[model samples]
Target chain A: MKNIVIIGGGTGGTVVANRLANRLYDQKDISITLFAPEKNHIYQPDLLFLSLDLSDPRRMFRDEQKLLNKKVNLIQQPVDAINVDNKFVISKGKKYAYDYLVIATGARLVPDLIPGLAGNNNHFYDYSSAMQLRDKLRGFKKGVIVTGVADVPYKCPPAPLEFTLLLDYKLRKYGLRSSVDLTYIYPINSIFTIQNVVPILQKEYDTRNIAYKTFFIVDHVDPEKHEVVAMDGETVKYDLLVLIPPHRGQQIISDAGIGDEGGWMSVDKYTLQEKNHEEIYGIGDATNLPVSKAGSVAHFQSGVIANNISNSVLGIDEKINYDGSTMCMTEIGYDKGLILLFDYSHPPYGLIPSRLNHLAKVFYLDYYFANMMYGLP
Target chain B: MSDEKVTKVIDARGSYCPGPLMKLIENVRLAKVGDVLDLLSSDSGTKKDAPNWIKKTGQELIGIYDEEGYTRIRIKKIK
Candidate 1:
């Protein structure tokens, strides 16, 4: 039997596993397995809502095994090393052999990469940290509440903007809009990375009286001064700081010598396959695709990878490629959101933030489980 | 109408955003140079996105037509 192994049980890995299982079920010679370190599959986008007191933590996760196809042997263990040359993976002191490998290991937040940023953890990229930020936001009445990104290539490109706008609405709900001084800082010269979406947010921030400081790279945070020091010797004081930390792929990928210094695996942008190894496919945040490291991107890439791999397994010579299709739901607040979509060849059109988009996002909480994870059309 | 013969017809009526485009791309990759292609998509975004993709790839656009509950996009593989 040919073994198809998928690592990292996140969106891409799960979708690939499910799609492959569904497509190759009747084929007697093929078997599928998924290696996941975590028992729970998190709906990470909900972390945005969870941190703002807008969603329940209970809705954020599902058991990883339940989400997988029964045909897929779910091995809940952290992968220690990848022996690509020998075509095997080392997990829990045991090596598992595979005929094909899919890397959807995803990205990890390196909060401690920035000194003084890894405290009680005030970021929403993960579950516990989001809850911690939620409590802090709940207690604060008025003072400088700083929300910013520490680096580029972070997952969910629009999240910092989403959080800043949603925080404005949160303050408005608390009847402390005028009392709180909210500021958004970005490492880049612009407030956001995407040029097309920046104007809409710039106008929104101006209308909301939300101040933003650009080119403010974080140097360190001084708890005694209640301020964050920038690389340029500027300080911004804050009562509460929510920072999106620097992110990198799994270290095992780098240690295996198949990834970049940042640990992100290199792939042919169109094929989603490792540059030199066609047997290995990389998807999701782990890939160095010039696109947003969001779930929708993974959802789109899943189809390409799954289709191509299944085609190969079935002895078909035809193959398809991914076009960097990515769509992100930018929630301005509980009531307003917008959809940003683009591919490798197209830039995003102008955005119109609306409640309809917000409702779609709210609806997606259900749709994600019903369709996305199952790799359904 | 031009005398060029059709090369392939792809029905991607139920797929969501970029699915139809992806189908077109797959077929485009498979088609020989100068081959004619058509795609049927229910996703309205394809109406706008497909032409732009064709333009970027230097492929020839035949036309996009409306059909019963779907849109038809025609193209010719250039290079």
Candidate 2:
């Protein structure tokens, strides 16, 4: 039997596993196994809405076992290492052999990477941060609230912008807009990494009276002073500082000596296959692809890898490719939503935020987000 | 999908993601209301995203044909 071992229980891993199982439903000669460190899988995109006090915290997660197909064996264990040459993985000193391996160990928020930021990351990229941020927003009635992205190459480039916009919306609805001074901070000259997105965000920020500091890199956070120190000795004091901390790949990848300095595994851009290792593949934030490391990008690549692996197993000569597809559905407050879609060859230019886009973005969580674990697009 | 008259055939096989979708939209804007546009792409994301785009734009997605090496998506411009 052809054994397929997948690591991580996040969007990429769950989707890839279910998609592969659904693709090869009738095939009995293959066994698919997924390794996860958690019993419940959190829908990460919900964290954004969660921070804004928009979504039910309970609905943001589903049991990992319930999210997978019966065909996939779920092992809720921490993977210790990946033996590429031996075609096996070790977990708890136990060996699991595989004919093909999938690395979907998504990026982790390393708050300690930024000085004075550990235990002070009020930003909502994870569960605890979302909850803490929601609580903080409740008690916050005045003073400056700064939302920014501290590091580059973080997953979901639009999130920091989304947080700023959505927070503005929430404060307005709560009658606290006048009391709160909202500012956005970015390391680059533009508010967004994608050039086309800047004008749109800039227009919105201007209209909302949202101030921003461009080229202000975060040097450290001064919790005692409630201030954020920038690289150029500039300081921005805030009653509440919400920022996206730096991110890195899983430690196992680095320990295995298979990942880059940032712990991101290298892969063929088109095929999503691990470089120099034909039997291994990568998806989502763990990969060093130039694509945006959002769930939509992972969602798109999951199908490509699944289809390609299915074809490889069935002895079909067919091939499909991932084109660095990135779909970012971000809400720009006032019940408006922005949709950004681009690939390696083309950039999103004509797209704009609309009420329909906002509705669709929220609707995704109501239905598609949960159904997606079952391989639903 | 049908023996319908094809007003334009856009070969966007090597194009990625929104490339094919953008090409479809560009041609759709110029074509007559009844014109049918054929978009060919090897990128899988368009195969899924194009249908949503068509539905949102109130256009007709004729069908998605999985050809040997590429995908053929047919669209009808409706004003």
Candidate 3:
């Protein structure tokens, strides 16, 4: 049997596993295995909503095993090393060899890299951290709530906006909208990554009266003094600080010599195949693609990668190639939502005011439950 | 899926993600247990999307048929 080992069970890994299973299942020639350190799969986009009690964290999270098919084997253990020289993946004190490897382990959130940010009070990435932020949000009523992106290319570019909007919603619900100050800090100069959605987001910030600090690259957090210090020596004091931390590829990917200067897997923009190793492919936020690191992009890339991987396995003609497809739903507080879509396709296809995106984002709940929760079963 | 109901259709073309499912869900809420909803979807993900959405909500998926440049989804609304 041709063994295919996939690292990481995030959005990219899950989609690739499912797509490969759809074709490789019932076949006698291939065996697919996915590895991750944890069984919990958090719908990251829902984390913003969770802060305001608009969404239940439990409903937005699930066991990774539930999202995967039975035909494939799942290993829930951290990888210690990947000896690319010998073509073996060493994890959990065991070694597994593979004919092909897919590195979908996505990016890592490095709050500690920001100095004093990953302390007891800091909750930036993952479910437990988000849950911590939710608790802090519930108890506190008056404070400067600042949630900002730690660095560039963080997952879901619109996340800071979503967090700001959710905070706006929560403040209003608690009747503290005017009392508690809210600010959105960003390293980027604009609100939206794509220039098209800037006006709409600007209007949202204006109407909600949320402050946007431009080009504020956070250097570190002095949690002891409740201060977020920027690289330019500007100090923003906050009683409640929710920050999106910097992200990097898994250590094993870097150790295996597969990453670029940014510590992310550098692959061909079109093929998603590693530049150094032809036998290795990447998907989701793991690859150094110039698109938003969102689930929609992973879903789109997984489809293209799966098709091409199958062709590579069978020695057939490789037809499908990823055009850097990416889309994300931005929740602008309350029940109002905005959709952002773009691809490598030159025509620039996406819709903003189209209610279709809102419906699409809401439908994801059903999509999650059906396609991910039950489809594999 | 009755031969008679196959003729009954809802023009859900140009609808995007969950729009077809939302409309079907709304129409399904008013439908009898055995009543069928023939949903049409143009969204790319609809091929696996509608059936998956129906399965999660515990609705019965009758069938998914391919039409000219679109898909006709037959779903039975179950409580």
Candidate 4:
């Protein structure tokens, strides 16, 4: 019997696990098991809505066991190490041997990386932080509200932009738009990493009078002074700060010597196979893919990984390749949003922000909760 | 369309996408057969989603009216 082990039960891992189980169901010799530490699977994209009071945080997650396929065995334990040479994973005190391993541990926000930024600042990267920011926003009156990203290569690149736009809309609705000073700071020169959507987003910011500062890399924060210091000697002060902290892959990947300095696993851009270890595959936020580390990217990568794994098992030389296709719905507030679709071959293109797209995002949330989580078509 | 009166009206004008669709599904389940339900939604997606859901569930879509800022969708509970 062949054992197929998957690590991380997030979007990428869950999809790959379910697809592999369904494809190899007839093959009684194959067994699939998934190791996930968390009991609840969070619909992360909805965190933006949760921050804006558009949705309840309680509705954003469901039990992970209920979402997994019945055919796949799930072990709720944190993986401590991966012995690639022995083809086994060490979780807690036990070890499970596998013929093939798929890593989808995804990324984690490292707020403490930036000194003094953890406690004083508000962030919406996690469920609790999003809830905290929601409460902070309600109590906020009139002052400078600075929303920015601390580093590049963060998950959901458009999230900070979405938050900024939503904040502007909420403040306007509260009749405090004029009293508040809103600013968006980006590490790069442009408002967005995707070139094509930069002008469109800039136009929206301009129309809304939302000030943006470019080329500001966050070095540290002075909580006592209510200021953020940049690496280039620039500083920005705020009464309330919303930050997207730097993100890195799970530490286990790095400890296993399979990840880079940033703890992200290095894999082939198209094939998603680990560079030094062909038997291992990486996808989603955990991999060092030159694409946005968003759920949409994870979902697309799962398709490629699943096909390639199946091909390998069947002794087929042909393999499916991922084109780095990624899409994100940027909520522009006032019940309106837009879609950004791009890939390796194509440049990012913006579909004008409208209420229709907002509805599309809402539809996606429902689909993700009902069908995608369960790995159903 | 004029002959059939709306028995229940779901004011989902300010609600977002699946919000309106979910509300429609919930209310439609409790609605009796031949009862007409009207959903007012500003979300452009519901214009298509509501009708698609109605057709998929074997319900009768009576009419869709284009209002000033929102769309009014009428459905008959056939199932």
Interface RMSD score of each model: 14.3, 15.9, 18.7, 21.4
Question: What's the TM-score of each model vs. the native?
Answer: 0.81, 0.81, 0.78, 0.81
User: Whole-model Cα lDDT per candidate?
Assistant: 0.82, 0.83, 0.72, 0.82
Q: Interface RMSD (Å) of model 1?
A: 14.3
Ranked by DockQ, top first:
2, 1, 3, 4
Docking class of 4: incorrect
Candidate 4 lDDT over A1-377, as tens digits, reads 88889999899888888888777778787888999889988999989888878787777788888887787899988789999989999988798999889999999888887898888888888888889999988888889999988765688988999899988998899899999999999865568766567777898899999999875667799988899887556789999999898787889898889986678898887889999899899989998665678988888888888788877787888888888788888888888888988876665566687899899998787787666545565
Worst 10 residues of 1 chain A by lDDT: A187-196
Better of 1 and 3 by lDDT: 1
Report the lDDT tens digits of candidate 3 across residue range A1-377.
Answer: 78889888887788788778876777778889998778788777776666666677668767888778877789998778888878889987899998788888888886666787776334435777777778877788777888776655578777777778767877888799888998888654466555557788788788889887865666678878888887667788888777777777778777889875446787777788899777788888887655667878787887877788777777788567787666677777666677666666432245454455666766676575466533332
Greater-DockQ candidate between 1 and 2: 2
User: Which pairs clash in model 1?
Assistant: none
User: Where does candidate 4 clash, by residue pair?
Assistant: none
Most DockQ-accurate candidate: 2
* lDDT digits (tens) for residues A152-211 of candidate 2: 558787899999999998899999999999989886556876666778889999999999
lDDT per residue, candidate 4, B1-79, as tens digits? 4569889887666444544665575456457899999998877877877776676556798999999999989999886
Docking class of 3: incorrect
Identify the leading candidate in terms of lDDT: 2
Worst 10 residues of 4 chain B by lDDT: B14-23
Off by over 4 Å in 4: A373-377, B1-79
- Predicted structure 1: lDDT: 0.82
lDDT of 4: 0.82
Report the TM-score of candidate 3, chain A only.
0.92
